[model samples]
Target chain A: MKNPYQDLPATAYWRTAVADPDALDITGLWQPKFPITMTDQTATSGSCFAQHISRAMQNHGFRWMDCEPAPPVLSPESAKTFNYGVFSFRTGNIYTTTLLRQWVRWALEEEVPDSEHWERDGRVFDPLRPQIEPGGFSSVEEMHGARAVTLAAIREALVSSDVFVFTLGLTESWRNSETGLVYSNCPGTIGGEFDAARHVFANDTYPEVYAAMADVIEMAKVVNPAIRFLLTVSPVPLTATASGQHVLAATTYSKSTLRAVAGDLANAFPNVDYFPSYEIITAVPYQGRFFEPNLRSVRPEGVAHVMSQFFAGLRSVGVEVHTEDQQQTPTAPPRRVPTEEETADDVVCEDEILEYYNAH
Target chain B: MPTDDHRFALIGDSNSAGIGRVARSRGIPFLGGPLSNGITLDGDFFDVEDGDFLPRVDGPQAAGFTGLFKAGLPILSTVGFNTQRIAQELHHGFYRPRGLDHSALSDNVLRQAIEDYKPGTVKFYRAAVEEGCDVYAVYSPQRFPEPWMALALRLERLLSGMLVEMGVSLVDVRPETTDEAGRLRPEFFTERENDQTHASDVWSAMVLDRFLDDAGIGVMA
Candidate 1:
């Protein structure tokens, strides 16, 4: 007898029980196992999401290669300014796969014809991490030297690091004209000229994204033979979109394409793996527990959820979970408090203050 | 006991020396500086026994040489008013090792006073060794560096062991009145709105009360 529910298999019915209603399955490309583990001195560099990964590595007892760190002794204001992370300095938003590719290519010091260097502020900027200073680099030479040294140092550090955790942040980025280098944030975010001619936005396709990741992974392997790559698409929605499309649609498209690319790369490269950080935060039915009041920064509970999955993945593969629970969480960026609107209830007369003070 | 024969030294910095008008009214005499009737009881000069300052008396008070012999305490040479005067006396060949760069500029002056006024501690200890005599140490208000408090704690441990060698116990006023950050406790100030480290009349009375408590002395009515 023919089964009545033949077309929709019993397995398909189970999706309602476990899977997110919005979960789009690119699982055919790469369905990760429960636990995965790798022992590599890891370095994270990318967009703001990369901060989370850096923190996670530090928390999880993973060897975090702080390729660059601000001087240990610094005044609070100096510490705030010299923002340390990737390459021991804050180079805002290393968005886009091509930019990520450029970072790896430059870090390896390989001859990539598209390499462009600029002098601004006191340093040089490669397309991978452009020099962002308020007034711009002092001279072209200083800028170029800085870029060269930064690239050289990163390559040197990568040669010894085992894992490179790259978080795909934005598909939109600004590129240089004569030299095809990428700038992190636009010049104005820190301080520089915002000339449209000097930059082009990269709304990359999935194939382009895949190729970029493959190139970086290949390049990283050359530096460190055992280099493993893990990719996660940042769940942070777009602040603005250059794609002329609706910002919401553009965000979906950007995330979807990157997610597809990540799946493709994980399938293609045995050493590469995809973590469901974006999924855990966005669609895992975790409710709204993860995001801060501003809908940014994974709430402590959300971070715990992600870390739990991460550790579960490690445990499944027999990787020892470093038992430092206290250190396993990274500090979240400060939440922006909304100002309360003034109402009649807030209005207090000066006479009241004097009256109260005298009585007290 | 003869009140004229008695000497009462209040040693410290400008704060201890009674800098402001509000601080001047404490019953202690202002021996080191010129006197004007800033306030009635706050005369700018101390009533003296010879040249050295003596405690003031409102009534007839007389005694004999036997009281001095019985007390066996050192002749109190009060230098509480100004550290500068104490620094001068010690540096002007009073102590063999000149009070130059002893620790800090402030500590140097204070240590100089200690050396120059050995008569007070020595005589007090001699009297108290077999019988009973009153001796006290007081710290004046000053802003101390936060980091130095920790260093001072360690130094105090070292100083404590050395104090035994010197045959005396040292009392730390820091723990009693300093806030956690090593600043003088805000509550200690009566005239808090000003920059004065000098105690006000109320604060002076409070400090004097604490001193009498430690010295086992009754306030002279």
Candidate 2:
């Protein structure tokens, strides 16, 4: 009698797939569930690592939808300083699923955040996206106005996008003790005063993360029934942990929880799929070679490798991967592809600000 | 003109040139008759034969308009001295300073741009202040009654705020020159059909009268 595992592919065995092959040569890491064609309007938001995916999609002549583009007057440098074009909208780094859920609710007019604005040195900041406007807005009215624009953009993006790629970043976040509003960054790190009584640290368990992400998908599908989700777990470890555990252990917990949620969501929803970027970078077979000198930031080569696998996976599924050169022939209109200097290792991670408080 | 031996210098761009034309037409004797003869910050008079009154300075002159400052001439300048150049730059794209309506730029970005793109009127005011000359910055009338002129209006407001912060007196003539709809009144438009970016001599006369009133200088009857 033949066992179920007796005639499996080489990819199913650790020795043939990982142990025997060179780390970089390992294949079949991801089999894309659906085809991501060039014409598909894709919107990306989540951790800083998600930026690479957005930029790569643009660079490859894919239609990476940017609903809230920087005004034409801004130079590329100025646009970046103002946090425009960093993500599909200006909701910088939706690190936690609950924050993602909150943004979706605001976009769909289902919820409103209690904290309107935070003030420091006479300058106002939007509590939802504190660091979006550099040096803060001039007034509370201006902060609200800017947030309204972003919320509108979020709505447009959710409704218009054919694919929404969200890289789940962390399980740990800070929340308002009373309102239960989640902030993108710790209150005091970027703006707002951190009070022990008013602010509370939250390390979401697997169940909470799962439910929030499911709600996000359900809410998005309500607006855009055809929208497909591609989820990934960020490989960059947590910069600091409010949990009493060591930073390393906290990172493992966060990554494991996020990874499990992503896997389960992909299993639960036909439209949802997981890409193994976290495992591709962090797995023992790779020996941590993809990290920078600090052993935290993903190197440019690592990003390139992950994208190669992404494109390769699409091609393996018979999806024609259209390159920029092929998409933009002599008759085609010009499109702006960010230069290598702009996209290379230029992820804006708000959590990295926490490292400033490190005693070491 | 009063012969009190008090000298006055008119400085700025085409709008200032328009004022000079009106003053010349009215036989008013200003130190620089036609400001088309551009005066540098160092007080050197150079003819800008092209009729572009941007006050482009060259050659060996001090950093400040020392000659006119030393003469203690009350300087009447137009806030639009460098606005034409800025308008040309902005034609490449639209950029509004933050806090204004429809603006996407932050104050920090606009502040950084000031070093590279400070208005000529502001620069002139600073030089005159160093020499203790009484300076009056006239807010020029809107050149055109078009939607694109909104940026120009916003820029004028920005410069006006800067001049006020520097304690430079400002003569606002918009109430008289602009219509109820916030456009330049058609009566103040130039005779040249092609030139919409310059006000007529009628507008200059009104501005000059307002400037004279604010400066406390009496015209000969």
Candidate 3:
């Protein structure tokens, strides 16, 4: 036979697929290897953009595995702001591939980094997830108690979930120079004081990030060999880059490196697959309608557009990705699908938080 | 108000069913069939269906409460279902039917077994009392894994407060597995897909023994 593309359909062509970026269905954007049934227990984590994936999954009536759920009494607004029920666990935004690796080791390998709790004005904070407990912990003991449950929940999520979705956010991060502990965000920006020597700004390289991404899937497979991974790169630009490179160049490098890692890993491993959320929001054809006024944040419509394609992409690959909205029982009025903006308010973005400091 | 008709009906969800499982695994002999069907303990032919969580379970298999207890039996459903569906049913019944995520339904068999215990218990309690029986209630924690665990723990606390406001006799069942911290043994309810995952009948019987021993339940006669 000739080349594989010779017999391929029009979906393989750029003019047909890429000619109109405005078209809602970017046919052949992705071809999923597995089906995502409404019954599939999906566990979400990783970058802030990952929350968008989770909300879409929830809105579609897909089972989103929540290892650490908030109390029912807490209003959705309050629960999200308090950093509860946002992710599978309260580990906050796992922005960097490096940090994601650290969490996997801690949860799966019993490797707890030399722990140090940051205290400010008599409030204790977990450097790994500084904003998890809104007001910060009252005591180191209290912080330890809460983190214990979170760690247990993380372990449970890893083992219980059928599919794990992780959105690669950045290649730049802040790490503990001494212990090699990866902090969620720059410490000084959130809770802890910045000691220049103690805190080192790390711009993870393509090789390192690529290795960590593979390690994450490998580690997850050890616990649940059947577990599948759906990888996406956050389209959100860098809030601020600590690297010596210009902020725009830093963002381009960070995203491209993470994107390459996702594509390569998906190519390397059968269980690993990549979704084109980055292309959906940032691709030139959509006229940049998905971004907010700031040009940095994804717009609500853009988030919606990405999710719509998410399911569509899976369907293109012969996956049985059904929306509960289509077959809902008639007894009740069709439930409202939460707009991306409604869900966005509750998003926990440490990078966007970093942008807040620069806003003033 | 308590009488020689010391008959009782269990009203809770799967935790309540755990007793029957324990009863059956050990072949605990009773007057009728499995408790989910019918059973007569201590000469009281309990209408097993009224209390069991299984669907369509009722008095036909055994003696209906009216037939067995001419003087009627107090209804006490030992509810300890820690689930988001029941929690949402009680707290936010509005967004239900489609709004509720069905994935939780598949992972935890008990999530489908979720009943709005507050109203269900009250309705069961009133119906029992109207039949000339006394009414009592009990609240306890069920060991659950993940997402359900946190919600279940919080719901348990909420259920305790509910028992107080409703003025129901709150009997706290401490099975052999429960510790001083009031936490149930996590293993008792883990691996919930299997029938034998909860506390054994011997452990639940300790709960029955505790119920009989409680001062609130004055009709030991």
Candidate 4:
């Protein structure tokens, strides 16, 4: 009688799939649940690593929708400086599922965050996205007005786009104890004054992360019944963890919790699917070669490798991956080549701002 | 009587050129030709028979016009309301300034505008300061209606702030030229039927009086 494991694919065995092949040549890493055609409108939001995915999609002639684009007057340099075109909307970095939930709720008009504004040197800052406007908004009204515009854009993006790709970044976040207003950054870190009595840190557990993500998916489905979600865990480790554990251990815990939630959500919802970008960057077989000198930032080569696999996986599933020559043909618009300034190396990670607070 | 010694150089677009034309037609004593070729006294005047007037200047003459600042003349620069630049580039035909209640472009665009939307005319103001001229920038009179007028006013405000920062004085004629709604009064518009977007000779005369008064120069009767 044949054993139950007989005739299994090579990918099922560690020696054949992980150890035997050259790290760069690893083939069938991801089998995309659904095909993303060139015409599909893709929108991205989440950690800084998600930026790489959106830029790669645009560079390859894919219709990565920019719901809120920079005004034509802004030079490419100024656009990047003001954080335009960094993501689908100017929500800055949605590092946690709860923050993502808050944005979605605000966009969908299901909830309203307390309109608390920060003031320093006479400039007003929005508590929701403190760093979005450099040097702060000129007034409290202007901050609220800007947030309203972003909320409108978020609604438009969710309703219009066919694919919504959200990369899970961290399980840790800060919130208002009274209002349950989850902030993009800790109160004192970016702009607001730290009130120990009011501000609280939360390292979300696996169940909490899963429930929040599930809520986000369900909410999005109510508005956009056809919207498909593609989830990935960010491989860039946390710059700092408020959990009182070693930064490395905190990073592991955060990534593991997010990864499990993402995987479970994909399994629970037919429209949701997980891409192994986290594994591609952090797995032992890659020998930690994908990280930069600090061993936290993903290197440019690593981003390229991940995108290459992404396109390869799509092609393996019979989705047409348009080549540069194909994109340059007369009928199609020219693919937007990423400018030197927009290179993968230049991601805007608000968490990196925390590095300044590091005690030597 | 204003003497030839008090040289007044008017530098700007067609609106500035239009001012020069109005002054010439009224037989106001002045001098000059095209701004690209430096301003000189051509002896074309009813009174003060030998005074110098600045030449007709447009955007192309910007380089040479700014250079004239070194001559230590009191220059009235009424430029920077190019309809093409305003409609196509600055506002893309539909942006509103921040803090305004009206719905226009998204606040992200407006916020970015607040930070980085420096008009191309800023370089000229900067050049005027670097050369140490007695420069005064007249806010470009609002000529269009509603949205365009609002955008022009916003641009005027931006240019005004930059001018102040660079130590250039501003000539605010809005109180006289604009109606209560902040639009150019219909009567102040150019008399030429083909041109609906320029200030009239009457409007020009009023602004000229203000400039002369601010510059502390005697106006020729």
Choose the strongest candidate by DockQ. 4
Interface RMSD of each: 25.3, 19.6, 22.2, 19.0
Instruction: Give the range where candidate 1 chain A is weakest over 10 consecutive residues by summed lDDT.
Output: A341-350
Residue-wise C-alpha lDDT for candidate 4, range A1-360, written one tens digit per residue:
999679999988898998999999888999999999889999999999999998888878899887776665665667777777889998888899988999999999999756888999988888878888778887777777778878877888899889999999999999899888898888999899999999999999999999888998999999999999999999999999999999999999999999999998999999999999999999999999999999988999999999999999999989888765567532322333444422321121111212212234
lDDT of 1: 0.50
- The TM-score values for the models, in the order shown, are 0.49, 0.77, 0.57, 0.85
Q: Interface RMSD for candidate number 4?
A: 19.0
| Maximum-TM-score candidate | 4
- lDDT by residue (B45-152, candidate 4, tens digit) is 111112222233333332333335445677776645443233334433224322223333434444345434433355556655766677777766576544445555
Query: What lDDT does candidate 4 reach at residue A334?
Result: 34
The DockQ values of the predictions, listed in order, are 0.01, 0.10, 0.01, 0.12
- lDDT, candidate 2, at B51: 23
Kindly list the per-residue Cα lDDT of model 1 for residues B1-221, writing each as its tens digit.
Answer: 43543333332223432332222344533222211111111122223233223423221211112243233333221123222222332333222232222231122122322333333333333333334333343443423233233333333333233333444433345566667665567676535343323334444455555654554544445
The 10-residue segment with the lowest total lDDT in model 4 chain A = A345-354
For model 4, name the residue pairs that clash.
B31-B53
Q: Candidate 3 at B32: error in angstroms?
A: 54
lDDT of 3 at B65: 25
Per-model CA lDDT versus the true structure: 0.50, 0.73, 0.63, 0.72
In model 2, which runs have C-alpha deviations exceeding 4 angstroms?
A113-115, A322-360, B1-13, B26-137, B143-152, B162-171, B175-198, B206-221
lDDT: worst 10-residue window of model 3 chain B: B37-46
Question: Candidate 4, B155: how far from true, in Å?
Answer: 2.7
